[model samples]
Target: MNTRTRAAIIGGIITSLVIAVFAISLNSNIFRQSNTQQNSIQNNVGITSKLKVVASFFPLYEFARNVGGGKAEVYSFLPIGNEPHSWEPSIQEIEQLKGTQLFIYNGAGMESYISKFMSSGEFSNMTFVKVTKGITLLKADAAEDDKEILAQGGMDPHVWNDPILAEQEVTNIKNAMKNVDPTNAQYYEDNANAYITKLNTLDNDIKTGLSHCKKDTFVSFHNAFNYFSNRYGVHDVWITGIAPEADVPPQDIQRVIQIAKDKDVKVIFSEDLVDPRLANTLADEVGAQVLVLSPLEGINQTEQQEEKTYLDKWYQNLHNLRMALECQ
Candidate 1:
């Protein structure tokens, strides 16, 4: 072959190699850019679709779950089966408050962590709901004074025990749900009405059962039933005052024992969360029976296994109350 022809062929092969390399590089860059765009789209979709909610405790969580109705993600600051008054949320949980959309709480003197959260402005962007916003409140009697207990004297926070107040809570939850998801307003209202109807039925059943009580007075280790007592016209001889474990003075014990003897009080109610020793001792002193009347602060292991709903626990409470008072 001629020299000129050989040189031309060598240059043409080099150029072909260069073009192939350039094409491969360009295709690789395009693929990487496409994948990155897909990832960005997915992340944005997740952020926009997530419905963040943080409930103060069990009752509030249950209410939020009912209203959220699978449309939103709901979580509780207080762990399941842990009492809210004593349980403290961790740093991770506090951080979750940053971008939360809804914050539901039992705001009538409950949630000691609320002030701190509000001060931090963690929930500034979130809409807050106090579930017990419109219920009739009951303050403990003047006679329910221990020096320590009187220091923190306020209205009872266990309003959920009264079905009537629970109906109000359901209403509040519905309002919050509608506020957050206006498009689902009718669904929320319907669910709330159905739940409130059940509450009314519970109220009627409780009233009917308690109507036949041999005595109107009932005793308990924890003062978790002031609202329940006042609602049903039943007298609560609470061994402890408003704050659980807030000192039971000697006079209070003496008075309780005297009343037990006088009224022939059949049963003394005790709670799982609080030490039952006090109630057991009091029952022994007065020959009264000891009964487990759960305060419904949280669900226990057994309750969890049973998948016990709020209404189940509430109806159980009604039965215990009726039995404790020895309803005929």
Candidate 2:
């Protein structure tokens, strides 16, 4: 072969090697970029697929959480230990509802600010679920002095205190979950049914537990237990009006003391989140002991850390009531 031809052949071989290397490097870079983009898209889809649920209070949060199970992410708008009757959401907290799909609230005048939010048209994309929609609300059994305050919005919002009504709330929440996330309808249905079964058992337990009590009337810090008392055939003589924060006038305190003495009440009940001083004073005046009768509106951080549920709190309340009533 001629020298020039040999040199041409060697140069051509080198040029072929360079082109092959460049092509391989380009293909490798394209493959990595494509893989990264696909992963990013999958992650975004995973996040958006889960239903975002925001509950107004503790009991509603519990109900929604149970119904939503794994398909939804549930949040409580009211922090633990805050009184729901007087709690007002801040602007930042309100802004957090932007991407939420469902907002579950107990709407029988429980949350005073809910109406403003509903009318603002700010959360048009979110579906608002009033768990108390189907249940019949009881009149707020407020004190005579607070009659005007109670009469303005006479309906009681503590329907969840009644286990039967709680079942209805759970059903409402389950239906809402199904409506928003139709693909997971059966999953939500199954979870709700299981929780409802537990609630039914709770109702039965309460009825049987209170049936044979020696006393039918009990004293409470506030009128939060009207639904519970009404359902179980017991009477509650509350110190304050519908809300725990309502001022207890001296006259009303004397009135409750007289009622407690006449009824031969052995226990004066205070709530978990309320100041126990009033109850202690009443108990001292009436020669009775003070016990906790939780409203289950919200629990403290310790209880939350302990993973206490509605059932746990109600059962504790039942135990306390049985002691107070001297149940057989």
Candidate 3:
């Protein structure tokens, strides 16, 4: 080959390589700038990014979401259908709390492990909300008739069962959100007010529905209805004790049957999430029908897919209770 042709070819190849390197460098800079801008927006424009909120259970999840009004990304620590009463958080779940804007949980001893989480002294930036505050707590009677043996901390954490108290819980959640993400204060408050109104309506409906019942006594599988019974003037006779044991004693079963027979109960109620086999045996023995009563705890995924609200579940409870008690 001629020297002039060989020199031209070498220069052209070097130029092409230089051009490719420059193009790559420009592309990398653009990519880096795009990432920096995204990170800056996430950091500086907090409201533009959804607030990270964590709820201990389903009821809290619903309340938080309703109050946030699609502005917050609310996640429930417990999955759908999990029984919150006995749930304990895993290490990974605890790690998630570190980045959340708010962590809302029903107090009143509902989440027994929360104290330990607080003691960890980590996640100092996260705002922890106890929705059960500013409300009266009910005592858990250790057993149906015997009050001598008080339960774990002896506080009934099922205050959400009472709509009046539930209103307060919803309020606490709203206020917490407003505090964390102050720009949306009015939005959260408005949503909270609307939800509280619905809860009020539910309370009235339940009162009116159960007012003229033929009997006020209804049987339950567990004693998680102190506030509901007290608020509505209904008598709840729970088959199992406040804390159900693995093997429910024969006497306890006999007592429930006797109560059903004495009160002329047509139906015996069991918790939806719990095993109803024991209640089934008692119902069979007493010749009574069995109904599943929700304590308004965490709902299953199926119920969520059906879009069942707390009010809907409560209404169903009232309907079943009226039928069981022969309400007029």
Candidate 4:
């Protein structure tokens, strides 16, 4: 071979190697970028696909959470330890409602502003579910000043206090979740059944425990326990009317005091979230001790920190009932 021909072949081989290396590097860069983009899109789509569920209060939040499990983002809009009867949503909560896929509320006057919020004509895409929709509502004896509250809806709205009623509320929440995310209906239903079983046990325990009580009547700071009272035939007498913040009339206070004494009540009951002053005063006046009866409108810090479920809290409530009523 000639020297010129040898030089030409060597140069050509070097040029081919350079081109192959560049092509390999370029392909690797493209593959990494494509993989990164695909992953980004998948992560975003996964988050968006999950249902955004907002519950009006803790009990409904719990019901929705049980049904949704890992498939949805559930939030109880009310803060810990706030009474729902007088609470109104802030602008931040209103803004969040716009993005919510499903909103659950305990109707029958639990949330007075719920009707207004839904009627605000904003967020047409969001679906609202009221757990008390089909259930019959009791007339909440409201304070003289708060008569308009009952006039607006004319129902007690504390149905979750009763275990059977809570079971219905849970079913309503599960059905609402199923309606919004039908793909996960079976999953939600199964979870709902599990919660329902817990509720059933609570109901039986309440009935059996309260049935043989030495006394059938108990005094409460507020009228929230009428649903439970109705369920177990334990008469709940409240010093003040439905609104926990409302003050009772002097005559009404005397009336409750007399009723307590006549019934031979050993303990006066107060709610967790409400101030115990009135109950304490009444107990002092009547020469009786005071105990806490959870209304369960919202969770307090201690209860929240403990991560107690509604079922767990109600068992404590049952024990309180047994002690106050002298149940054997």
Candidate 5:
């Protein structure tokens, strides 16, 4: 028990305490860094794991959204309030397509620019799904004067207007999704089946609702309802051709007016996004009321914000048609 030995023992004990504190602080810092890195990696994976789907327009966007459910992120190539009949994607938008896994469009010449895009071979990795693949297209019913405006022998591209064809489109979308992401095949299948069931109900409702109507012929702003009319055994007397923006000829206007009078049409149909002045004039001439008949090409920003869906719009259209046709 000498004084020098006692001092040496105390100093050694203090040195051991300092080393232990340093080691604990170092390990704590290392653990926090590791956790932060792991969280960041997890966040990145969560984002990239979701399938990126690009749809040509609103209906396809909705169908893809329903089919994708939580497994995919769907984007509409056409902006809100824009008509799909003449919408062409910008360079920036085209470039954005490179990042997506699938592109869904209603092909039957619906998208005029799609052929160019497909032939360009720019999207080699992306799978292009034409929802109208199995559905037969009807001849474009353009007015005699506007025949030159629409391409010769053009097929109607509004197949989504018919619930039965919409079911087919949904099935095509589901197939495309499954082909690209087989890991979530069952998930996509379930979601698609649920939507298809809703479509089946819609089909039945439309058939039953229109069966007892007083009139079978209706005046629409454009020839966007051939598939719908053909399905339900009704007829559409459209003012314009396949393109809604086509100018209505004076002769055609007089012709439609005569037909309206002969058929005793109570209502003239206009589109949500089109200029309604012409429809109003026709209505005034025929002593009929004007109502909206949306083609569902693209909804406005307000409708998008309200989360309006395809079925909602179709039901609204049906209600209006029933009112116009004096359906029982």
Candidate 6:
């Protein structure tokens, strides 16, 4: 072949190959764009997603989750089972609040740290639900005789321990969910109704189970169960006061020991995440058993993995109380 002919053939071959490569690259890009569009379409067609809510603690999270069902993503500000009274949210946690659509709290002295956020209205768009609204409160009756403790008269705010009051919390959460997403009001209402049905059954069961208790009083390490006592017609002799850390002064332990002996109370109840040395000591002193009665303020990691919710812990608490009080 002539040299010019050979060069022409090489040039023609290179042109054809370049054109084929360009066409394949363009087709590949088109395919990627099509897949991206399909993914977006599928996500859009999924069930209507609800707003993200952040609860201050476990009780609020439980109510919010019930109302939200599978629509909302609910999270607690504090990790499960951590004590909220002493927890301080980090800057990152505050930044997370920027995206939260609703914030729920117990509100009656709990989450005092969040007070500034509530008052300043940084979360103006974020609906704040206080679950304790409209529930009847009980005075600290144990303090009635102890003038020193009586001087501090704030109503006990752990009302979630009461099944009826817990339903009020559910109602509060339902109303808040409705306010935030009125379009799905029926969904929230249905969820609340279902939850309240369970709560009513729980109340009835508690009443029936404790109907024939030998004694009405039980002893606990902390004073968080006043609402539970008032609601269930049971009384608790708390060795420690509202602050879980309210150390059992030697005199207080002695007093609890004497009371347990007189009442024949076989169980001394303590909670998870707290050192139970004092409770063990008291139990040893009085030949009683120590049992764990979770307050459902926060769940530990294991409890979370076990899918333990406020209701589960509360039911366990009821069982323990029944065993402790020997309620038939």
Each candidate: how many clashes?
A: 0, 0, 0, 0, 0, 2
What is the lDDT, from 0 to 100, of the residue 229 in candidate 6? 83
My TM-score estimates for the predictions, one after another, are 0.79, 0.83, 0.82, 0.83, 0.83, 0.80
Error of 5 at 228 (Å): 0.9
State in Å the error of residue 96, model 5: 2.2
Q: How far is candidate 3 from the true structure (C-alpha RMSD, Å)?
A: 6.8
Tens-place lDDT digits, model 2, residues 149-262: 354467777899999989999999999888777778899999999999999999999989998989999898888888887788899899888888888889989999999889
lDDT per residue, candidate 3, 151-255, as tens digits? 334667778889998999999999887776778789899999999999999899988898887888889877779999999989899876665433567887778
Q: Which parts of model 4 have CA positions greater than 4 angstroms off?
A: 1-48, 143-148
Predictions in order: lDDT: 0.74, 0.85, 0.79, 0.82, 0.86, 0.78
The residue-by-residue lDDT of candidate 1 on 1-328, one tens digit each, is: 9999999999999999999999999898974665464345334433456456778877777777776675667777786667665466888777556556678887655676675677774344567788878776777463244332233345567887777888888788888767766766787788778778888898898888888877888887767787888788988877877656568879989999999889889898888677889999999999878888877787877777888877888788778877877787
Candidate 1 matches the true fold with a TM-score of: 0.79
TM-score of decoy 3: 0.82
Against the true structure, candidate 2 reaches a TM-score of 0.83
Estimate the TM-score for candidate 5. Answer: 0.83
> Once model 3 is optimally superposed onto the true structure by TM-score, how far is the C-alpha of residue 220 displaced, in angstroms?
0.9
Candidate 1 stretches with Cα past 4 Å from truth are 1-50, 142-153
Tens digits of lDDT, candidate 5, 197-238: 999999999999998988888998888998898899988898
